[model samples]
Target: MKTKQEESATDFLKLVKNMKYFTKLKSDNSNGDLFNVTLKTASYNELNLMVSCLLKASICALKNDNSGYSSASESGIDVLLLLEMALQLLPDEEMQLLDEFHKNAIDRKAEQ
Candidate 1:
């Protein structure tokens, strides 16, 4: 049987997967029915998915509370930096796409 911590970790992973899927559906202008399809394409270690989830959670927290940025304020920034660092750990094409996606997200936020 799994320990409580392990169960919690599993639950967190499921939450992240669902959150990432929902955010992608919202941003892609695609049908919500495609949420599972998009999520199926994500690997457990996918940096893009992880970063996307982090961005979504951060934005949600910022909108719902007046706590300000807190120590977690730099999470999205840290995710971007980690993606850059992960370039050495991932394939060239994967890294290139992630860079492009990151740039597009930043551009979209700037426009907003």
Candidate 2:
């Protein structure tokens, strides 16, 4: 029998999937491009850490190469330092605008 916490965690994972969070994932291992493939599945603990930490790291990308998020980290390369250099190349206003646009899009979806 599963404990209540276990059940809740499972449910939470389900919710994330239902919300399309898992729909946009790209393989870090490019087909024949990279020497090794880094197939990763976020563990429950890791997901908890990410959510609790408000990770803005874009280490992960969408399967369709559309949307992504990024965050700061201490290590030169870790789970959370994605697109930092590319993001730096972007203007602050553009970032802010993108944020606002995303919010609006989500709000519109929720309204529907």
Candidate 2, residue 78: the lDDT equals 50
Q: What's the residue-level lDDT of 87 in candidate 1?
A: 46
lDDT string for model 2 (9-108, tens) is 9999999978877544444554644243233436745544544443344423322133323322322335434443333333477568889999999999
**Residue runs of model 1 more than 4 Å from their true location after superposition:** 1-89
Q: Model 1, range 1-112, lDDT digits (tens) per residue?
A: 9999999999998998988744644433466453332333356367556656656665565554456645344443444444444443345687789899999999999999
- Model 1 lDDT vs. the true structure? 0.60
Task: State residue 112's C-alpha deviation in candidate 1, in Å.
Answer: 0.7
* Model 1 weakest 10-residue run by lDDT: 32-41
Clashes of each: 0, 6
TM per prediction: 0.24, 0.26
